[model samples]
Structures are given as structure tokens and as C-alpha cells.
Target: MIHQYQLNGYNIVLDVNSGSVHCVDDLAYDIIALYQTTEKQQIINKMLVKYAAVPEINKAEIIEVLDDLAGLKKTEKLFTPDIYQSKAFDFKNRSTMIKALCLHVAHTCNLNCQYCFASQGKYHGERACMSFEVGKQALDFLVANSGEMTNLEVDFFGGEPLMNWNVVKQIVGYGRKIQKEHQKNFRFTLTTNGMLIDDEVIEFANNEMHNVVLSLDGRKKVHDHFRKTFDGSGSYDLVVPKFQKFVKMRGDKNYYVRGTFTHNNTDFTNDILHMADLGFNELSMEPVVCAPDDPYALQEEDLPQLYGQYELLAQEMIKRNKSGKGFTFYHYMIDLEAGPCIYKRISGCGSGTEYLAVTPWGELYPCHQFVGDPKYSMGDVWQGVTNTELQTQFKLCNAYARADCQGCWARLYCSGGCAANAFHATGSIKGTYEYGCKLFLKRIECAIMVKVAEATLDSTATE
Candidate 1:
């Protein structure tokens, strides 16, 4: 069997190179170097019972290895310097590079969903759809900041992006134009309700954009439970069949159907199956956030059920991916943990990378979740990240800066959970992320197990 090494106390991270063990403290090299200086690799199983006891490090072993290599000192080394520089165990690159740009095409939606986070009652603010000029500026920010990346994704999002098709058309048209001019590849995705997904949107999505994130809360009854119009009527009856039509229009490969669920959902399992059967190969399910007058809250037990659903769904998608069936969720939430994490600005998700949301008024914010909110707004596009004399305010607000989160195994990968969610849950951004850091780490572990299992099954089949 191949060597699989894990450190005591820290189970999420694995030191693949030195076959050593150390905590993912700040995802830096210091801990690894410090651990190796103790020669813990020499007595791999030796338990250090006493802290005051002198270390029994073996210098002879080092001399023996050095002597063995002395005869070949003149031989050219095969390894390149770049290989050594990039040897730090990490997923892809370290800098929080922005692979996706979320453009807030519009703020107002055609429908008045009851539980809409950005709805009238929930959100005490208003801004129209981003004009073409603002969209161009957002695109310019990405183009200028995009380093060592040729493929860029532009994700159109809003209360309902389809409500403003003209802006979306102009943005995509301009993005493609600029991409060609700069010799870069530009991809597109959209997040919208199927209520407005007509022929023009379908044509643009299928032929131009990569995916469309349709907001279907679940099956009709469960969906109608929370998501409704301002008239207090369910949107399910309207969106379900249209959802099917939209799915058929673009097919599974091009479009991804996503849904939200709250405690009001009477049948969560059935809803998952409903979307799976509705030809939505890519399905994302998130629990609803409670309101002040909300009667229900998500129970902790729901997580296990969610885990089971993800496992089953991933298995089904794996089979589909192998047999060329039809659709896959693209291994949505797997392969996060199970490796040494490098400390970098960007992690698995783009918290600091190429994702920034610009509102209609040319205000620059971290993501759509912040947008016009002054509390979360990083800076204005007019001012150019200059709200403070420090580095980007978003960087100051980033999840990695908390003292409570330092030395956390999930820090490098999760980059601290969403800063806005942190603020929403607790009074401060750093405050709540501390409480939920372990869960983020746990999610990474769960993803790693799934990826490992998938890899093993594939290897077995090949053998």
C-alpha cells in the first residue's frame, strides 16, 4: 500500500511530500519546517511523553544519506526550481485568483418571492439593473486583475436577471468582444428563476453562456411553502413546468438547476428526487435562513439527511459520468480536504479571488450578498478599493484575518466561511466564522471521502 501519513490532533491535512505530520497553522511552511526540525519523521511512532525531555534526534541518519549522495554531487539535478517553489501541497494555485465574476445584472425581480433574501421586506434597499457602462467597468476590473488565467467565467446574478435582458445581452456581447480582443476565453453563467427564461435567454444561455442557475425551491408543495409572490400565492404552479421547458431548451450539460429549502419543507427527500427526475442533473440544495417572525428553524439533524442525499446523488452522477448517461453535478462539494493546505488569499471558493459584484451605481462590493449594503461594501468602483488606506477592505474583512481562526486546518481551504454569513450569524464578520469553522472543516473531510471513494472505484474498474 502507498504511504498515507496523518498527524496527531490534526486529521484533515496530510503532508504528502515529507511523509511527516503537522497542523495546518495559517497554511504556512513554518509549521512544517518546525516539525521536521524535531526529527519527528525519524521516530515516526515515538510518543513524546515529556515536554522537558531532550529530543533524541539522529544526526547519523542524515550523514548516511548525505554520504550516499556525495558520489553523485556532480550529476545534474532533474528537478526544476519551479517544481520546488510550487511543491507546497495545495489545490490548483494559492493566490485567491478570481475564476468567476458575479455581475449583478439587476436588483429588482419580476416575481415577489416571499422568502427572497433580496426581496422588498427582507432587503430594505433598491437599485436598478446594472447598466452597460457599469458592467463594462466590472469586466475591466476582472480583465486587469486576471493573472496567469486565460479562462474566465462571468456569472449573471440578481433578484431575477431575466427581468433585465437588455443589460445581460449587452454585457455578454461586450465580454465576448473584449475577450477576443485580449485573446482570452470568456465563459458565462446565469442565476435566475425560470419564470422569465424565454426564447432569447435560452438561446443566449445554450449558445453563449456555460450554465444557468434556476431557482426552484423544490417540488410544488414544498416550494410553495416558503417561496411565493407578493400576493401570497405559490410560484411552484408557475415555475415547475416552465422549469422543465427551460431544462429541455438548454439540456443538462449547459444548465444547472438549483433550489433552496427551509424548515417549512414537509418533504425534502421527495423534492431532491423531483429535481433529479426533472432532468436537472446539477442540483444544489441549501436550507432557508430564518426571519424574525419565522415559525421554524433548521434543525441540526437535517445535516445527516443532507449528507446522505449528497452521497447518493454523487454516486448516481458518478455512474452517469462513466457510462456517458446525461448529466453530472460536476462533483459539486467533494475533494476539499485530505491534503496539506497552503496559506493563500484564495482557497477552494473565491472569497478573495476573481469574484466581485458591482451594483448599478458603480459601487464595488465583495459579492452580490453585499452589493449596496454599506456595512459589507468594500469600496466604490469610482474610488477603486480606497475606502481605507489599508489593502483592499475586503481583504481586511476576509475570513483569514481572525485571530480565533489562526492555525485552523480549514483556514487555507475554506478561507474562513462567508464573511457576510459570519456577520449575519454573529454581530461581527470574524465572530460567527469561529463558531462554524469546524463545520467547514468537517465539510471538507466529507468531500475528501467522496472523492477518495470515487477514485478507488474508478481504479478498481480499470484494473
Candidate 2:
């Protein structure tokens, strides 16, 4: 299969199956489009007529390009058969095993960040915390529905999970108690905003949780701008020291200093540099996804700068690697070397399939992003996914189900985009936002460039 688009004044063609990219002229682009359906002679004839008025329209050159494309096709580098289509998995036949769950432990937060997607922890609903009873029952539900899976994952997520510290600890202890009896191991993760991260919380997380995600949006000024306290004060001073101390205490454990970039901070490389300067080795900076009209939301004009920032970040990563002090940047660590192929990409991270999120009230959702949204609630902890039809819908919602994805080379990499983002932007899981799509494509291009640069450096050093 082939996907073609014009980007930065260049006609780019991507061979989806073979993972080859080519830059071609308008004639070659048109010829490729025509060759998909028409005969060779007819394609050539049509191309000649289309470029008939142009002084550059040389019959010999057109034939030569056609011959080159044909050679590529003959070598199975272009026009490869759609093997992935026939191999798409049937969601109905998938196992009903639950492997991962994101438990919303706290329904409130200490900070009132302006761009908070969770509506400042209330989740657009009444403020409440998960009770010990509900947390224990959620763990029981996971154990019962795990279906022979020995290793399970549970994430303590919330407007601020640390807000309900007691229940979080109780659930972890309960999970440990039941592990031996159920013959299943539980790996816990906590995502916190760093406000309530005291010594005890840090110690408990390091000892019990497999990983922790600390929320701090890059530099002090930038982080303070959007992620602030209820009184409109910057949180950098409050959290940075705690984050540094926690990382020091939790030495060598899996954790990441996570941040978000918005329209106000498209040039986000400086934020990353500040984090690195603060001794954070593991970092994840994600773009804020919000309504277009929101002043802080990333818009079309912001993409160019964002793409440039990615390129700059990639270069910095390469420099750090060469200097022998390489740190993992979440987006830059895309494993293109051993990544999934089209077949495996058909289903995404198994949101409604292998993964589910439980709210403070024991209501189930596909993920944390959909926790407060009632339309997406698949089931409750007691019932164990009562909505099989909704699960099936999510299961079947793959690249093949989207018309736009069918022609995208990055389809496999993105797995037909995030269902939550899709639902939020277009009111359907099968839909995709155009701005997000553009940003995604640009990121893929940036990733490819980074990988190529790294490979070239390695080759040169070896030589």
C-alpha cells in the first residue's frame, strides 16, 4: 500500500508495507496515483496529457520515472499486497482477560491548574474520594477477571491520587495480601501532582509502587504559568525540592518527571533542558489536548513551532548520548527498531480489551481520560464489564475501521490514534482530529529523522 502527501513544498510518498519513504515530483506523484487503478499504458497516456502544456514535460523522462517505480514494485518495495487487512483480529474472539487497570483513588486535588483536564480533580462531578471498601472490591474485580494472567498492573490515578493517601495505601496492602492466594502479582503505579508528596508518601510509593509519575511542567516559569495553586501562585518552588528529594530517595527505581506543553510554550525544549539541569534523568513532556478555543490549547499555528521543538529535542538527545550522559526522553525513545508491524498495530493498547479504568465509585471506563464521562462507562467493578457491545466496538475500532488511517503510513505506529482524543474531538472513537493528525505525522517524521541521524553516527564511528 502507498500513502502520498505534500509537506513543506515536497511531494512525499510512503510505502506502508515496506516502510520506505520517497520524495517525488508532481509528475511522479500523479503517475503513482493513476497507477493504483489504471493500466500502465493508460497511466502513462494520462500523465502525458496532464503535463502536455508544460515545457518540462518530456516523454522520455516520464517513462524513465515510470520504469523506476515499476522496478521498485517488482522488488516488492512499492505496491506491496495488503497482507495486514486479511490478518485483522476478530475482537469478539478475543479473550475476556483484564491485564491492567487505572484506579481513580482521589476525586479532588490540591492545585487548581488552569488547563487541568480533570476539572481540578472533581472530574466535572461532585468531589469525593474512593473508600477503602470500593478500593478493595476493585482489586477483587481485577483478580477475578484476570483470566489466568499472572502479572497484572494497577495505576493509582486521580485529580491527585495523593489526596486520598489512606485508601491508596490500603489498596496496595490489600493487593499484596491477595497476591499469594490468587497466584497473581500486582505491579502498582502512582501519578501525582507533587503537592501532597510528603516523606511518608514518597517512602510508601518507592516501597510499594513499581513506578511513579511526578507532574511538573518543565521550567519554573513555564510550569508555574499553567500548573499553579488555587491562589494563582507558582508551584515550582513547592514541588521541585520534593521531586528532587524523592528521586534521590527512590534511587534506581522506575519513575518519570512528567510535564505538559501548551500553546503558550511551543518552544518547550528549554523546559526539558531545565528538567535535565535539575537532575531528572527520566522525562516525559506531552502536548496538552484541550478545546481549540481555549487560550492555552495548541492550535494549527503552534504546530510548526512544536515540530521545530521536537527536532531541537532530538538533536539534544543525540548530543547527550554522544557525551556519555544520555537520558530517556519518552517521545524520543520510540522503538522503531523493534516496533509493532501492521498486524499487531490493528488493535491499540487494548483500552477496553486488556485494560480498564475504575473510578472512585467503582465505575469502569476504557482509560483515565474517560473516567468522568458517563457515555464511555463500560461496566462497574461488581458487574465486570457488563457492556460487551461497547467493548466490541472499541476492539473492532482499528486502522481498518478508519478511512483516513487506511492511507496513512503512520497508522501502525499510532494504532489509529487515541480513542479518548477521538471521542473528545469528534464525539466518536472512530474519529480523529485534524490538528492532532498533523501533529502526529510531524512527530513520526521527526522520529524517523532522529533514528536516521543516530544510525548514521553509529556507522561513521564504526568506519
Candidate 3:
């Protein structure tokens, strides 16, 4: 939250998370504690009342406390987290920005996973894999257009990206080339189904890519029920053995475990623990999307139950996180674990800001979900990343693009939830995921409560 303060002769503003401060619209020193008068308190209080329009009572308290304390004052007008967040998107110095690009390598997958979001199983019209040539071409465009990316990240996605291993290989190869040419540090990751991620792929990935997102929805029974091979045999056993083999790749650093949760895979908390028991450290989860082909589905009222499940899942993770064991979350993963979200301007989950997509034919798109939705496709592969209507919807379709998330203060925090998911599940971006959005806000509120509680304890300790 952005809060403003006046102390001594400076107007102090702080971005509470990063502790970045500004004084008189210029860079000011950050302060962790504020009760030590040190002669700067009186001037500060008066300044707050004058410049910040601090509440009279708060100003009186500040004035009373100013002469006696060094770094403490009660200025109501000071910028706090909520105040700063009110202007999050417009804040000039906010530190979140897109640091990586999730590039879809192949639109095709080897197996048809029931809970698959990309609608990969259906061989509908124009649904083909991105050829090796088009893959290289897209990378070329990305590298050429990466004007100021110092630490660029390339995230590979697919039906089962390994189906087009050549595409993955070339992107890695070209990513290296770009890293060298641009003198930047580049990182690579792949989200795969682990079917063909054999020794050869592991070696290349370990050497070249830093992380790999391997999907494991639940325990064997649950996973196999949805993810299956062409013959309808369960892919769970296949994935488990391969995952075991992959983790046994002789490296102490285990990075290839990702968990996805669908509505069918109930027991949200157990699923989290289950993944941890599987020796995986992190997981990303979303509600399962059922296309016309999905056998099971909700009757509309089931969304609240799913929302409750999400809350329970979040609470479980928080418990595990506090248990001294290593666990990671996927949606708000970086914000919770890493030092604040680096990529700014709402979590641009493929909504046109930094980098978009090029279909197998090289047509630009907002994301892979649209590989089926032709209206969102820009130009064919031969053309560049065209700023098409789909692209606009990707960013500015505020109604569908942002929707009720706009009314939310956490809107920027969660990047208005996933845009594609918004369209797919809600029927339009204007639609609201009341459950998903509220769950996120609840978690954010939890963080706030924890911070407040910590401050209270610290105060008692000092006293």
C-alpha cells in the first residue's frame, strides 16, 4: 500500500512491500521503524498536516508524538498499502512488470487429457502443430523485438510439447543465440505431460532450461481417470514412472513437478499434500474446463463449492508453508514466495503487453486458447504479431478483459484472473469469477492480518 508521511522537512512516501520511499517527489530513504523523534518528528508532523491533508486527530497525535518519539507519528493521510494500491496501475515506480514470455511451441499434443484446457484432443479444422520452421521464425521475432529485456524468460507450452521436440530444441537453441547476441541472461521452462520427456530431453533441458513444469493432477486413480492415451488406457502410470525417472536424473535440484487441479479431482487440501508427498515442491492449479466433449460438469450452482475448495486449498498450503516444509503455489506463486511480482501492470497472462503468440501457421494470437477461436487470430505465420481485435480484447476489452475484477482492489494483484479462463468459464470477460476473485482477496487479507499481527507483537516486545 502507498502511504504518505511528513517528518522534519520531508514528505515521506513508501511502497510498504519493497520499502521504496519518496520525499518531496524525489527518492527518500526507507524507514522500517518510525518512533524515534531524533529532532525530525515535529517538522514531519506539521508537514503531514500541511501537505498531506492528514486528519486533525491523527495530526494532533502526530504532533504530540513528534516531540517525544524519533520515528513515530500517526498521520492519517500517509500513504499505506491500500492507498498506494488504489493507484497501482498508474503508479509510475511500481516494480511489477512482465519479466518472461510464455511461448506455445506446438498446438498439438500426443495424448488427449480430459481436463486439458487447450481442447487439444479434437482434430478440428486448422488445428495443427507448429512446424520446426515456424517455431524458429517465432523465436527470431521474439528475440528481434526484445529491445530492453535484460533477463528474458522463455516458457514453452503445448498439447504435449514433446510431440514437437524439434520445436522445443530450436527455441532453446535460438534462445541461447539471442542471449549471446543481446548480452542478456535468459531462462527456459517447459510445461509438459511427461510422456516423451526421456533421457535425451532431460539432458538438454537440464543443460539449457532452468525449470520444467510437469503436470500431475492427483494420485494415480484421479489422474488416470482424466488423462489417458489413445487406446483409453490411463496415462497416470505412464506419467508416474516417467516422473520418477525424470526426478532421478542425477541432479540434486528437482524442478520438474507441477500440479494442476480440476473440479473432478476433489480433496483440494489432500491434493496439495499429495503433491508434496510425491516429492514435488510446487504446484499450479485451476478449475477444470470442460468443453462440449467433457463428460462431467457443474450445474452452475457448483461454482461456490469450487470457490470454497480453493479457499480450503489455500489454507492448507499456508499451513504447509508454515510447517517448515518447502511448498509453492502457482497462481500467486511469485508474489507470495518471490520478492513481490516483478512483472507490472496486472499479471499479463498472455494479454498482449510484452509478447503474444503466433499460431502454427504463424498467425498472431492472444494465447493458445484462441488457436480454435479464429476471430482472435491476427495474421498467418507469414505475418508478424499483428495487433488484432483479439489482441485488443487481450488488453483493452476492459468489460470482458477486466470486468468485476476492476471493482476489486486486488484486480492488479491477480491480473484480473486469467483472461482466457474468464472468457471460457464466464462466457465473457464481463463475467465475474465471484469465487476465484473473492478467494484471492481473502488470501490477500490474510497477508494483511499476518503483517498487522506481527507489528502488534513487535510493539509489545519493544515495550
* Candidate with maximal lDDT: 2
TM-score of each: 0.69, 0.84, 0.70
In model 1, which range of ten residues has the least summed lDDT?
A: 76-85
Question: Once superposed on the true structure, which residue ranges of model 3 sit more than 4 Å away at CA?
Answer: 1-102, 121-127, 248-256, 291-295, 298-324, 332-338, 341-350, 380-382, 388-403, 425-431, 442-463
Model 2 regions lying over 4 Å from their true place? 2-15, 18-79, 89-93, 341-343, 458-463
lDDT of each: 0.57, 0.83, 0.57
Model 1 residue pairs with clashes: 96-346, 96-353, 98-354
Better of 1 and 3 by TM-score: 3
Task: For model 3, give the 10-residue run with minimal summed lDDT.
Answer: 24-33
User: Candidate 2: lDDT of 407?
Assistant: 75
C-alpha RMSD by candidate, in order: 9.0, 5.1, 9.4
Predicted candidate 3: what Cα RMSD to the true structure? 9.4
Please, what are the lDDT tens digits per residue for candidate 3 over residues 1-463? 4544432233444444343333332122222234333345555554564556535535454454443322322433232333333343333223223344556666677777766667663324444666667767666666566666677676777667787788778777876776776677777777788889788987887787777778887677777777888788888877877777676673765474665555565565566667778766656655555553465554356556655565555455544555567576665353333444533433345455455655556666665565557666665445654544544444443321454654455554565666666677678754665555655665544343233323233222112
lDDT (C-alpha) at residue 131 in model 2: 95
Ranking by TM-score: 2, 3, 1
Q: Mind giving the per-residue lDDT tens digits that candidate 1 earns over 271-291?
A: 766787776766776556545
Whole-model alpha-carbon lDDT for candidate 2:
0.83
